[model samples]
Target: MKNFKNKVAAITGAGSGMGRELAIQLAEQGCHLALSDVNESGLAETVRIVKNRNNSVIITNQKLDVADRSAVFQWASQAAKDHGKVNLIFNNAGIAFGSTIEGFEEKDFKRVIDINFWGVVHGTQAFLPYLKTSGEGHVINTSSVFGIIAVPGTSAYNASKFAVRGFTETLRQELDVMKCGVSATSVHPGGIQTAIAKSSQINESLKSLGLDPSHAKDKMAAQFITTPKKAASMILKGVRKNSRRVLIGPDAGFADLMQRIFPGAYQVLVGKLLLRRMR
Candidate 1:
């Protein structure tokens, strides 16, 4: 929406990274916030930051695990009740696991999908009704550059992000067909300086597969070319314009360009990059 003042925005994963930054910025814009995170301390910190902003913003903080579909629905209802109406839902809760498809444990892979892919699904479906009731609404789901291009040891993460991209795109189309004012945008953020890599659970078996887990994490941190604050600002700008897809970094734009130009051939290019990293 062009104006954010007095609007109610609900953000998943509001404890840190882009989510926290979005909450803070929205507060400054006079938007009331419903912030949730599995990390209680981080969520509290986010609430405190938003409340301390110059605007008198309403803040609701809750410990939520987005993977739980029922809980997400419940939270949406509660947030609508607490804030009077919901105009935006940032389905930003996500996690990553480092593993080849062969090296990943079935359970671990499922865990990643539950939080990363299904979490977006849960948040979207849960809040959609409330959004429609608000007359105008937007859903921002976080995908990744990995969603556009697959990497050697991030199968689960790639799968989830790719799914998010597809789902959000389809949701946007459906909203258009239904003539609903609620719109959705899929976000592809190239390596931002977030704890995602450090928080990643690497498959120990990756070493046997000739990939160094420690080195991979290091490479990940090195690739973080954008700050979360910058990413958050870009996201809000995209929301105001109702952008269909928001690409957050130069690297993300480059990857999207390469994917359009090379398509399947880029897999081989990425393979070469992986080998170079191994060396």
Candidate 2:
């Protein structure tokens, strides 16, 4: 963990966003990588970018859906054998699905929960043995700023991310008490420029909020993101220091502070602010 040089990292969602950036950063330090994503082109693109900087580092690519328990377990086992002592596993793959309670379909809800929530669980549990065996490994799970507070029009996503936050937090405590060498980090990131929003299954309630799909997408793109590369750098820095919580943006830090300081105050304050225009 202290020395990333020549260590191996197995990252989920390595096709894009923070995952891709992590690969680039780790590869720059001469760490070997085993990257997985559902999108072949994006995966190849990430590998290409990393190799462009350093071709000597070992790079392995796999097309994986982290929600598939059998596949996830199989891939983790194979990756340990292939890479030899996987020192890091970034459980970073996620999807966003926005919907109201009554309006969301079961399939849409399940898809978000499966990928955003269960995917983290699958990756952590499936890969923990290998990571533990690797000695001085770290597990990083991506939660969201919304996980600290339920955001409007993102109920399903909020639920899944919140679940991830809770799960990772508890796991960290258990590991500490048991004296596990592998430390854990829960990432709370404010909107980064990713395909998540573009891919959201926004429902009627979201549409009724008078947010033009195109305009909202553009606004999110412009407004609150910390760059994927910077996010990756922060994550690695946190893992190096074995920090329990890593906040990636001003928005995330603000939300985190309010959540712990005045959880109810922010909750009601945000509710009234959002409802003022509607009324």
Candidate 3:
């Protein structure tokens, strides 16, 4: 756990953004990679990048949907078999949705939960046995700043990420109590320059809020304070240090502090921010 060299890492959502950056950075550290993503081309690109960086490092790419429990288990088994052993599982696959409970359909909410919450659960559960057997293992689950503080139009996303935070935190404690070498870290990232917002499923709530979709998108992008590479670096540092929680970006740190100092008032602040965006 202290070093990544020659260690095998299995990453979900390894096609783009932080996941892809994580793979690249880990490759630079001489870590072998097993990467998965629903987007075949993106996964291929990541694979190419990693292999280019370290031709000697083992690299495997699979088209995967983390929401599928059976598929995740099968992939984890196959990955372990292919690589001989696995040391880290980065349960980083997630989706973004923008809608209030009143505006979003039940199915939409369920979809977010399946990929964002259950996906983490599935990844951790599926790979845990292999990780435990590896003797020195780690689990890094990607949450979000929204996980710590609720937002107006992201109820489903908030719910899913909060569940992830709770799940990973409890898993860390359990691992500690069991005296296992495997550890878990929950990551909360603020806006980074990623395609997540562009790819997000936004409900008609934007229309009701009197916000133009394009303008809203621009505003979201403008809020980004970090790059995926930087986020990846911070995340890897956290993993190396066995940090219980990793907060990425200054905004994320600020949000965590604000929540800690004004838990109840934070909701009001978010509401005001939403109202401002509506105008």
Candidate 4:
């Protein structure tokens, strides 16, 4: 919102990466923070950093697993009660499952879907009431460049991010129909340096599949990815502008264009080479 000063903002996955950075940026702008993550230490660290900024706002940190629907709903209710109202909800917690369909494990598959897809569902649905109560609010859901275009070896991740994009788009339309001031925006970040590349669950079958998670991380990190803080600032700009779809990174904007204008060309170009690289 234009008047971020003194407004309350709630974020999921606020322990590290872009989520934590978003909390800091919003706090710097005078927004009160309600930060949640499964990592209690990380959440506390985020709160500590935000408080150190001399923000004239209260910061709350909670250990939350966004995939737990009941917990998300309960905490959302509590957050609204404690903060008075929430003007922004960043449903941004996500995981990466770097597996080809053939090499993917069921456990990792479910974890990716639960955290990346259902987590957004839980966060959006849980916070909507509070968002509505605030009269006007914004929802920022992290999809990925993969959400729009699927390359090889990341089916599970693509599915979850694609679901988030579609879900957030539908909510945006619904908000319009219902004439609610609350709006939803989907995020397509190219490759911000996040732990998902390495810390992500990659099954042991990768060696058999001739894939290396370590190589994946190294290749990704070499992309000279935008910092989490930069991504967070871009996200805040998107929220302020009420963007329908915010694409981050220099590569992401190009990818989005190619996706819309040259989907079939983009497919053939990235696919065969990408599949070969995977193996």
TM-score of 2: 0.94
Q: After superposition, how far is residue 245 of candidate 2 from its true place, in Å?
A: 0.5
lDDT per residue (tens digit) for residues 1-279 in model 4: 666888899999999999999998888888898899999998888888888995578887778999899999988988998998998899989887677688776887998899999999999999998898888888889999989888766789999999999999999999979877898899999989887676666655556545676676555455647889889889888888889999999878877888889878999877765556555
For every model shown, the clashing-pair count is 0, 0, 0, 0
RMSD of each: 1.2, 2.0, 1.2, 1.8
| Residue 5 local lDDT, model 1 | 94
Per-residue lDDT for 181-222 in model 3, tens only?
899999999999988987888767766666665566666777
* Model 2 root mean square deviation, Cα atoms: 2.0
Per-residue accuracy of model 1 over 161-239 as CA lDDT, tens digit each: 9999999999999998998889999999998998888888887767765777777777667778999999999999999
lDDT of 2 by residue, 141-162 (tens): 9999888887666788889999
What pairs collide in candidate 4? none
What stretches of model 4 exceed 4 Å from their correct place? Answer: 204-210, 272-279
For all candidates in order, the CA lDDT equals 0.90, 0.85, 0.91, 0.85
* Location of the lowest summed lDDT over 10 successive residues in candidate 1: 270-279
Q: Candidate 2, which segments miss by more than 4 Å at Cα?
A: 272-279
CA displacement after TM-score superposition, residue 217 of candidate 3 (Å)? 2.4
- Cα error, candidate 1, residue 215 (Å): 3.6
Candidate 1 matches the true fold with a TM-score of: 0.97
TM-score of 3: 0.97
